[model samples]
Target: MSWQLYEKARGLLSEEFGGIKKSFGGKITIALCYPNTYQIGMSNLGFQKIYYLLNQHDDVLCERVFLPFPKDEFSFKKKNIPLFSLESQTPVHNFDILCLSVTFEADYINILKILNLSHIPLKCKDRSEKHPFVLMGGICATFNPEPLSDFIDIFFIGEGDEAIDEFVDAVRCFSLAINKGKDGFYKRLSTIDGIYIPSAYDVTYKDSGAIEMVLPKNGFPQKIKRRWVKDLNKTPTSSKIITSNTVFGDMFLIEVERGCGKHCRFCLAGYSYRPVRNYSAEVILKEVSEGLRHRKKIGLIGSAICDSPYIDEICDGIAKMGGTISVSSLRLDRLSKKLVDLLSVSGHRTATIAPEAGSERLRRVINKETSDDEILDAVQFMTSAGLTDFKLYFLIGLPTETDDDIDAIINLTKRIKHSILKIAKSKGHLGNITLSVNPFIPKPFTPYQWERMEDTKSLNSKIKMIKSGLKGVSNINIIHELPKWSFVQALLSRGDRRVGELLYKCCELNGDWFKTFRETNINPDFYIYRERDFNEVLPWDHIDSGIRKNYLIKEARKSKEEKTTLPCPEVGECRRCGDLGCVMNI
Candidate 1:
């Protein structure tokens, strides 16, 4: 409640963040935080969106904060200076709430660092009414919040547009009633939409290694429907876009659609965000008009931008307005001429295609039914439409992946390059193609959860062999992720509540992963590299996200048996996914 930190954070805002100072209006201090370093956090569109959203609230002023970089962390520790918000150089503790936007499993530890910097306790039980209430949102919260539940005060599930608005309203009301309000705000806040107070529930694990029951102990609803905007077109993306310091700097971001119907077996987004939705053509044009004022380039954001019925119209509108556009990779099976022509005319030279796998056989395992011929056809379209450069994305080490199946990577890329070359010779155009090889990490609730990740050595060898085979394909190039990051991601994604210790240790050691491992008593490999039994109880069993465990088990069984499952049509009740209790419900 002290203004000391707020003054420091406000100083930072005035000195470094020009846009933030302009939006501050000399009152109402709030810190919109991305729980990672400036370099990495600034890259996320969600983080930027929240920064833009909060600042636009007239009565409320928004500032910025990110996880301190390693060097900055050392400097702060040496000087004993607390972490401050970007806008006012105000201390993180001074804000009414320290709102964190967490997008990935790995960033869980970073929240601990930000909290420690704010002089707040790492664990929730260690804090009191004197501290800033910590609230978190984003994809991980939507899927699973139990592992980190003991620390965060509030977990927001699903889309934040509607959920956060409700949260802000509740906070404002609480601010007005603080002097005479009843006790246990956590219990009261849990009653709000999309809000799950982790402290209000009780869980009983059965002896059979399953969650026996999750009873709502307080006055909170048992089920929290995910907040979704009925009319996404009017939901922001306005002129005051925050692009100056972000990864996609000076680029306008426009949403073409939200949700998807592809319903891939191993994809959580395919299941969790049910019933596809999109912006109308008119709304899209309006968004773009506002976006282009800040930047000349547009990055269309969505699960399947191509699937938006009005994608062509939107792309054309941007082009006609003298803006360039970058698109998400497509199914290739659905790449259309109007889309290609619109992009080509805008001087867009590179197009991306996500085949997911080299062979159609592996594609079927993931429910990506696009054929090799279809992919080749898309390459031909890109080439013929005067867009020569292309990037191909593929996954390796999926369940049922064999050496023969992997050869398709080389085969497909070379064949694609040959087609592009043949067309280029006739059409007098030259082009280069790139193939980004990524390893497939099986995730929980996905059909492949039952499958084991391919041994790291084997996957790397396969990558090397594939690259070796491309000796003569000059037009083709290859790039891939370091295997270690994937290994860490696997370790974190499925880890139990026990991992909180490791994450806290990680941030405490200045983001040193190795030292964090040494300090922890638990073996991370046990949760990461080890396989789980079908009857084992997971750490995230307490939160209810609306999906069912039975369905996930069935899907896992189907994947194990090499059988394909069809997506339920968007007709009636959306069947629950196997993981029942999740913050997605929260």
Candidate 2:
């Protein structure tokens, strides 16, 4: 081990406010790995929450590890030192279990880099009893685990609130009986719900390179259903460590709600995290009161923040504690005056809203359920509440998008900026507006899962058209994501085990995807541009998100017909969307 690297990590740990450290002796040691830089990984509330949850077990001791820094990577390679944990500077291979929290598809290549730098085998089949078992979870794991299935040993199928406890129990039971070999160990884990053991299943491919069938052996469940916490008040899902190293370092974060009731056809979270659940006002007030002791700013995190029944009270309570409040992008329809008033008094200067598409026709196809006039009204309300900085998020290359729709985006943005100026000038102030445009990437388990992604050439042309239309607009900043990177995201989100070969080629080329494609025989376009039929077997069919296939197909047909589906009922009525059972549990 490198003493210099160990001291650097220890120095950072000492500066944190609530970092946990424990002895690994006579305990089931687990390395909680994040495949990103320390600064970025430490900022994630999910990573911090899982670290806190795992350490609560008396028999388990969890430590943190991240991808080595650029200079540290070279130094470790020169010294032949394996990646070590932050708590005690112990090698990762020395731990009994190695669990990963993967949130983004673009980080798939970084996972490969972490394994190679740690001197661990990249493929799960090559690992043995001497190596620590590799487990994966998070949003990326929940929807589709096939792209990296060849590497992950086990995948936690859903939310980590309850799944973490279930996993720790399995670890404890398996460790006590050392005589139980690998087969016995797998069988014991299979008995637990929400755990997917990929090695125990075999996937067959058809002649046309599509999935034929997935067979289970040794009584493994044919379809792995996702697990989630029924009650949000039962657990604490907040940031445990406070340090000024991450992007959100100055703020303490808490999840006010989970799942989205607004079922947008193009959104994966809307379909995957079904049956919206929210933390009660009392629970949120308790967390905010406790969090104020460490930080002055509190970020309310949720996919549907405005949907919470107690959002106004939560925001008001935080203000009483003398803490500034930050929130995720809010829904346009739910942007009430009372909510905006709470935000203005809580020292919020910037507001964000996502109008997903510009034209009403395009919006109906994706089920955004918001009109251009409604978006303008929301902005007027926000500015009236004293917000000086505004952000508008939109997406390009959507299904059924036309050149006129692209022009509508420019016209819509200009109208929004004009409204902001009209409101600002009345208040003796000027405001700035930022436009964030991104390319569309079809994800698995959503209504648009089988939709074909627009090629880079077409996306680039559309992007240029938007830029040209907004050329002379002042106080409006246009920021768009590159088309090339979106292509990479689409491939990873819509690929199978066959994509594993491309990952290896990328590692050898040192993160160069274009060159890797040229050198290898794999055609990236096959995965990105190919549209599938509803009857064909999808890559993620083996893992069920509790949403039935028939419902999604029906929704896709409705999308083509330009019909809109209603949002989830606020009163928690049974809608029979196949997640009705989970809704009943709430």
Candidate 3:
């Protein structure tokens, strides 16, 4: 019975990963821990992409280990069996390396829980050459890593396609050096690109609650250069794809491009992944070729796909290859006639457009500078292109949103729907539109850092106002996200190490979110739904993203006064974001 789970893992693995023995000469055991549930972990395209990559290496053997389900956890507890890899049934402590891939801030607690169950030390200093090398890579570590600094040994920042390939070779070299009686294998690993060893750095806080300095203890680079993969089209993310069950079971996803050209002031991905990198048209066409074989629809992922600069060329390529392509998000300013016409040919009915805010003033405040004319033009273009069903995304509770500003939402939708109805009726085409409204959640490393989220009750009340104004619209569908969930996202996004324990308590209590107030004996409101002084030390202060604090403070003040600030996309070379090293010269 104990080995039943083990045997199933082996059979499934052998069927999918039997060819692993044919890339390296020496045997290497790797445990890929998702640090979340099977359903949650399985859903991640980034996680699965790597799983396929490592298993293809003949010298490297990889297996899956996820945060256990409740029933499986109970079974393990009853038998006193340690957390082990699914493929070889080998305990995690026996593997040479434990690689955790993460996406969100909330998953930090689960990372610790997975480590504890795997018999690994909770602290970085306690682990030595005898145990598995603990490493982490994902968006979280790239931006704000101080909160998880105590636990993770090494962090791989930015894109990992080229970095991970180089990383495996380095790991193999280090292991061989260690076996040959050279003791400094760990230090040697720190010298690689995109790898950050926090233990070698020193952080000092001033009495006034500001970071005095972040210095390296031993010989280390002062500032690490983020890794870059020049041609995304050649070595695109998923060359050999995985087919199985996932959290997003009903959908098939394809990476259209990575990084963003539009530098929305609040976006970290805009700064961290730069130079407007994209996969070539041929690469996108090939991935979609495989996607067409799937039962589900293919999702085109990117910071903004419509602004790919050569989107018409790419969409036309995808259209020539047969498949329904669902894009991540679109900018109204970038939809050209050729692009819209190509979308018509591809048989896409539903699309999403994010204006961010209802009012032009608020839109400009966040550097989302598309005009009302552009939006109406986009609607007309889509109307001509046969796009009837689509969504309009807006953010309520913005830094400077007023009653008139909120009323702009009612007015904007009213105008767009009126045009759609008139255009549809004259042409005898039936078009259905949905307006999705959500509250704004400010995160660290954004220009809105010093700003606070509005209370949930007020946000709901404003939503009610929008609903009342939209009652007269006959054919439009409207959806609003629950403010409470946004509140949880805010809490986790801006929280420190203290809230990590709170996440475990929430998991134990089955996610009664408000219960954090009782369990932690602290007000969740203080950290999330309230404003903070500009002078205080932020929890993410110890980590440097190269953006200055004064710039964020200035932007926050500008937002409050309803003043508009623009990024490079709107103002061109006249604007600079202070993180000059992170931006593209073009």
Candidate 4:
């Protein structure tokens, strides 16, 4: 209703290159909401892809809405203006459906804020036919939707490429049922695979605060199987909207792969997105040719991009088309001179690598498999290819980590710096080595789900140790995430529905989580600092990710013994993880 806010939305729409703006007449309107600022949400490729896919339907008109900037939030509150979509500046509450694309657990509080701003009911049970159905999807929702079950009406699990079509049909059926005053609206949606209606399920907990059982109601499926696009080429995931208002604004992005074959014990992405699939070089080149028309630089996206077999061909095609290429990071063991040289030619001065663990012994515990010698060699190769600066990522509180491993981080970084300096001296240039360190947070469906997170005090001490060890070293920068936030992240990652109450209360206090914990009877440590038994029922047990529980138990045991597992073979029946169906179909 505020003209000032309406003007702001129009200003942003003017800057975008490719965005859908359509008449809402006779259309299934959807407000694609992202619970983050415009700059952060616009940078996400997944969010952009969904918007593109939804608008491709003739009857569907999807618009974008984001959390207001911090300074602008005051005006929104002062003027009592509801949140509006960017394309048409329509009120979000007027849309037929409010689909939330949630990727991080930290943004759970913001979802409540967005709903309150839009004048919508915070709880799903309180919303009626007049209110827009609140649906959610993304990586966080796929693994565990229980924590947000009370708020969302429907959840789309796994990849959204094919699931979106199925959801549209279900929504149509529900709309007809609503007009007839029928009670089977949810039951109609339950028939689709990967569509979870949380209201149709019941969860009971034991006296010890562990989940006892999760039962389905009204003949719903016992387990909701995750759905994924079997073939990567069928769905072309590239940037649909190009604007200079994002993190990687200067480059056009394309997804080269879907999942990682490397089975890292602490990784949720590696386990949840099983049976790794890659986009063919022909498809990638075709995308690059189209993307080059908008931007001169092409950004390749994937879990392990350098491990793709068509890496050289894709880079070569981009080069021949006079387009430079950029990747988020490279695998240490897969680094090649040709790839590094191509990156240098693309005007890239810094190369990023994630060793994850500092010591080789600790790396084995996490199943990283890459040796310290191999990491140093990769750095040497990059420096020789004219890369001056380097960014190294490591986790401080990994399982089985000791003070010796902390010392190893310092020693390994210094060795990498020495390697770079030896090459830089000949070129008369000195480059800085940056280290990004963070505390480890266990995620659901991973081998570390049952493990306890290190206490904040000990994690702080380890961070201080790393800082003190490298204090006097020049041209070496250390940037570590706050330990307290990691504690909050861990609690949310492994929490049940009870934690959602705390999340709502925390939002009411304007994001003061510490005060919320003190006021509530819930013990945050019960979710963060406690290890679980193998027989316990997890909050996400009813959500089938196709990876068996027994396989995760076996992997957890292997982690304790400091054993390493080989990466998934390119094409074979891998029965090790009980994901043979996914592997064989690939």
Candidate 5:
């Protein structure tokens, strides 16, 4: 091991507040890895919560491993240093299990990089009894595990809060069996509620390269059901470790809720994370009180935080404790005067809102219910509360997008700029409005899953149109993601196990995806550019997200007709999506 690398880890550990270090004797060793840099991984609350939960087991000693920075990665490659955990500096391959928390498709390549650095076999078929079992979880894996199926031994389907404990128990029960071989242990884990053993299933494809069927082994279930925590109150997710080296370093993070009730047709989180659940104000305030003891700022985490019924009460309670607050983004339709005032008082100069589409017609197509008037009113409210700068998010190249829709975006942004300047001029101060534009990538399990992503050339042209239309406008700045990268994301998001082969080849070429495509027989465009028929089987058909496929089809039809589905009722027995009353119970 390199002394420089060991000392670097020790320095990071020294600065952290609540990291756990325990004896490895008689414990199940897990190297919880995040396939990114330390700065990015440490900022993720989900990764931290999993670390906290795994170590909560008296028999499980969990440590963190992250993708090394460029210079450190070079040191590992040149000096042949094995990847080690942050807490103990032990080689990751020495652990019994390597649990990867993957959140984005772009990080798929980084997973291979981490595995390579750790000296672990990149493919599950290549490993033996001596190799650590590879497990993956988080939103990306939960939605579609096929692309990584060849590399990962097991995939945990849903929220890790309760399911992880069950997984650990299974591991402990099958400890002796694991020494024999992974086959029997894999079969045993296949019986768990949320566990999916990829090797235990066989995927067949048609001549046209579409999935014919996904069949499980005789003992395994035909479909793997996603497990979720029934009660957010019981499982209070908060920052277990505090460090000064993260993005939200100055704040204590807490999860106030999970899942979104608004069924935006294009959103993966909305479809996959069904049945919205919120922590009661009492629970949030108690967590806040504890958080205030450590940091003056509290970061509230959730998909629909402002939609919580007790949002006002929670904000007021935090303010009463002399703690400031921050959130990822705000819901335009749900903004309130009290919330805006609290944010302004907390010294928030910038706020973000996602209008998604510019035209009201396109908004209906995506089921983003906020109208143009509501968007302007939200801007007015925030500016009146003393928040100076604003970030507006929009998507280009959506399904059925037209030139008029692109023009609408430019026109809408101009109106927002006008509104901001009207407020700033009177206050004798100027504020900027930034447009964060991105290409629309089709994701699995959503209504748009079967739709084709617009070509990169077309997407880039639309982006240019927006930039050109708003050229020379004062105090208005624009930024966008490269359409080419979004195309790659679309390919990975909707790809099958065959895509795994392409991924391996890409890694061998040092992430030259273009060269990987040119050298391989697999066609990347087939995955992203072709629209699928409703009768065809999808890559993720075997993974049951509880919302029926038929329900998704129905929603797709509604989108075609420019119709909007109502939000899931807070108190009702409606089973529109066939979730079996998960909404009412929550």
Candidate 6:
């Protein structure tokens, strides 16, 4: 059984391209561990990007390891087998460094599972010098590393492309330095920019369980500035591996842009990844041409790929090459006819737009900066351009949302569907609309970061209200994310290290978050249902994600007043956010 499991892993890796095949002798053996299944982890471009970057180094040998399949975990534990990597089939614990790519907060428990299966200590302090040093990176780690800080030795607080070289160089330097111990290496690692050694910091809490302060010691910087590649054109991001076993399978993915210029107050990615960046048209087309050789489908991914200045050219180039182009959601206001026409020619049937809120007032509150007319116009253009399927995205439980706003969603969708049907009738076809609604979870570093997530009872009430309001609407499908699950997301998103225990309990209960909460004596309300004061220290306050707290505070105040911030300053000076020393030229 154990041999079968190991072979299964080997078989999966054998299907990939651009994976590292290196000799581990006299090299920094690093296990690039993802706390998830192989199929899911392999699908992530960021994970693939890190693997590509780490393996480019001659002194480092990075191998892939993931949380075992449930059945395989049982088989391994029964056989007393240690978790091993796909490349060398070496035990994960035998590596010098364990670099974890954690994008989602829910995967926190899975990290623990991976540790236990590998026979490594779960807590950072529990591990001796003999054990592999664990470092974490990804979107989740940059903004809020505190939740999993206890278990992780180091957190890379920036883009992997920018931090990987610095990180590996630090590791190389530390290995050769005098006093090759944990403490010495940690201090050395801290000196490198964007590396946060959690143990070097002390977090104090107030009597009300709110953060009092987070103080850094041992010469660690109190604030770690997020790093970015100065010129995005220099480091173009694209898929390195191609497999048919995952989402976007067999589709070559390229990141056209990074960081959103739209300062949507409810979005964490918008603020956490500051100062928009995009690859030039030449670079994008070059990558797309290379991708066409391997796969005919191209997926343009980024927070704001539509905002790429050369988006029309990129789309047209792909269309001319006879390659199908897929994209992330389009910005309604920024939606273009040429792009939509190219997408239609590429065989895309559905177009997605996130209005975020149904009501204009609520849109203003969230700084969505999109109007109803703008959304309808975009939809009309897409529907007329041969796109029949329409997907509208929205968020419930917004800061100032009401029942009227919920009803507006139904009315708005009806208008969009009416437009779609008219366009489709002329083409002798019908249309379908899918509404993907989610409950808003105020995230760290956003203007709404200090706001409370609506209670599950209130969230459920709103969901039902929307459902009833949309009842009997033909050709329209409503899919809402479970609010109860979002409560767990909010808890983990803004939680401290103490929440790690709750995560462990949940794993023990077989992923039962409710029972875990009850058994751990944790009140989900404390994290989700209470509004925070401006004076209170947030869990992620120590991490400088290129945004100022005062700016966020002012933005929060503006949200209450239904005011909006301008789009990101891509051309001129916008001193509205970030610290004084930000690298953004604008």
Write down the worst ten-residue block by lDDT for model 4: 174-183
Give the CA lDDT, 0 to 100, for residue 214 in model 1: 64
Worst 10 residues of 1 by lDDT: 577-586
**What tens-digit string does per-residue lDDT give for candidate 3 at 1-586?**
6676566556545544222333223667788888887667766767777777777666788777888876766666677777887655779988888988888765776787777778788777788767787878777777666656677777776666657667788777866663632235546766776677777777775664345567765767666555656667666664233445454444567666676756576666776665456666777777777766663356667776776655677667666665555665667877767666655665777668887778788787777788887888888778867876669998888776789888999998888887777667766766777889998888776777767888899899999999999997787877988998888778777765545566656655655767765867646676786677787767666445555678778767766665666434522333255553432222
Give a tens-digit lDDT track for model 5, residues 229-347: 88889878888898889999999999988888899988999877777888899999999999998999999999988888889999999999999999889998888667788888889
Q: Write the per-residue lDDT of candidate 1 for residues 1-586, one digit (tens) a residue.
A: 3344345444434433226554444345667788886656766767767777766666677777888767676666666778887755767887777888888877877778778878888888798777777888887777667768668878887777765566666676676674623245665577676787766777665664345666777577776655555557667543243535556666677767776667577676765565566778888888788777777888788887777778778877887898887776765765757778777776778888888788888877777777888888888878888878889888888878889888988898888888888887776666798889987776765555555666678889989988898987787889998666776676676665556677767766877877778777877666556666666655554444455667667766766566666644434334445332221101
Better of 2 and 5 by TM-score: 5
Which residue pairs overlap in candidate 5's backbone?
none
lDDT per model vs. reference: 0.71, 0.86, 0.70, 0.88, 0.89, 0.85
Candidate 4: segments with Cα more than 4 A from true spot: 178-183, 583-586
Model 1's alpha-carbon lDDT is 0.71
Task: Estimate the lDDT of model 6.
Answer: 0.85
Q: Candidate 1: where are CA atoms >4 Å away? A: 1-29, 39-43, 55-58, 178-183, 202-216, 220-225, 425-430, 530-536, 561-586
What does candidate 6's lDDT look like per residue over 295-386, in tens digits?
99899988987788788888888888888888878888877677888789878899888898998899999998777888888887888899
lDDT of 1 at 517: 80
lDDT of residue 533 for candidate 6? 95
> Which regions of candidate 5 fall more than 4 Å away from where they truly are?
177-179, 584-586
- Better structure of 2 and 4 per lDDT: 4
All candidates: TM-score = 0.87, 0.97, 0.83, 0.98, 0.98, 0.97
Model 2, global lDDT? 0.86
Q: How well does candidate 6 match the true structure in TM-score terms?
A: 0.97
Q: Tens-digit lDDT track for model 4 on 1-586?
A: 4677889889888899998889989888999999998888988999999999899888899999999987677777888888889899888999999999999988988899899888899998888778888999998889988888888888988887768888888766665563633247677778888989888889999999999999998778999988888888977899999999889999999999878889999999998777788889999899999999999999999898887888888888888899998999999888755677789999898999999889999999999999888988888888888888999999988988999999999999999999989997787778789999999998888988899999999999999999999999889999999999999988888988888898888988999999999999999999999999989999888988888898899899999999899988877566677653655323
Model 5 lDDT-worst window of ten: 577-586
